[model samples]
Target: MKNIQRLEMETKGIALSQQELIIYLQENGLQPHEEYNAQSPSAKKAIYQTALSTLESVANNPEMMRNVKMDDMTVSEFHENLTDRIDQLEKKIRGMRTDANQSDFFMLFN
Candidate 1:
């Protein structure tokens, strides 16, 4: 019973990590290319396997594990930090778009 409970908890953590990765990719417009998506099941599996291997390698690295342990922040604090970074990036992008439009308008008048 204890083993089952531990396995269930680990499975939940992996699912959450995968979901977060998917969300991050989508937010960054990093969807799989159309050709890859249209490929057969084997091809898709290969892609996913590569991603999983990469993640596992990083997670198992001593330096990376050390960094994770050194972070004293709570989960909520981590989320808040990421939120602020996203907000700043969005604002910067918006400002760039506005500046580009203004430049185009001035060029048209000139």
Candidate 2:
């Protein structure tokens, strides 16, 4: 299964935000599902199921609750984190565009 598709399915099941899903995929070294071909349907299904199960388990985990104390975060801290995340996302988008342009250039030149 492609990593992105698996992550998408898992994120849907767990109700995770895009940022959280991206972070989880990166942490697990999983690529987006589109990176995989359709020849291995069974493998893709298995990966999707596994990821969904794991996400559900983690969403219900008490340990995760203990680690992120919402009450402890100040408004300013939350705002700062949101701004930082937005900046990071903007950077990633720019990088993706650059990569796409490079690939296009190579295809044309090579």
Best by lDDT: 2
For 1-110, candidate 2 gives per-residue lDDT tens digits of: 55666556434423455666655555544444446544454434434444544444454565653454467785456445544544554454334432124343445465
Angstrom error of the Cα, residue 52, model 1: value is 22
Clashing pairs in 2: 1-44, 2-33, 4-32, 4-33
Task: Report model 1's TM-score to 2 decimal places.
Answer: 0.30
Query: Candidate 1: which pairs clash?
Result: none
So what's the TM-score on candidate 2? 0.32
Q: Which stretches of candidate 1 lie over 4 Å from their true place?
A: 1-70, 97-110
Query: What is the per-residue lDDT of model 1 for residues 1-110, given as tens digits with 9 covering 90 to 100?
Result: 22222222322323335544444334433343323432344333333333443345444454543444325775455445444544554454444422124443445464
Q: What stretches of model 2 exceed 4 Å from their correct place? A: 38-110
Ten contiguous residues with the weakest lDDT in model 1:
1-10
